[model samples]
Target: MTSRENCGYSSRTIFAAWVQGNFRIAAGCFWNTLDEFESAVDESYSCEAAETYKQAARDCVAELTVKLNKAGE
Candidate 1:
């Protein structure tokens, strides 16, 4: 399943859309990052770009994966 967490931001939006199960068209900020990517997210959470939250989630998942792998070992 695909999930999304929206943060209050104006010009900077971490937008990405995709169908969960099979294959479908991906839109928004997912495949459309480099086109107009910028530091448009919230100023309080200032960082590089709008992909900050996304990268954070990815890093968390990666850590979980490594932990699970070690547990399985």
Candidate 2:
């Protein structure tokens, strides 16, 4: 069974919440980080990229948490 199913939450609900909270952060972080990486490499990177990376990391953590919780269930 999927983690959401194991935890008693429907996959839809889990995905919705995940999208609302974690996805946003993740997307943001990814873009931001990308920017940072680019800047580090080129020196003309956008600040937004760094933020995206940070958000992506945050989202990943949230996603992992949900997965772990489901596993525990």
Best by lDDT: 1
Residue-level lDDT of model 1, residues 13-68, one tens digit each, is 33332223212212244333322223322333555444665464344334544644
lDDT of 2 by residue, 12-40 (tens): 11121234333221121223332343343
14: Cα error in model 2, Å: 22
Q: Can you tell me which runs of candidate 2 are displaced by over 4 Å?
A: 1-46, 70-73
Residue 45, candidate 1: how far off, in angstroms? 11
Worst 10 residues of 1 by lDDT: 18-27
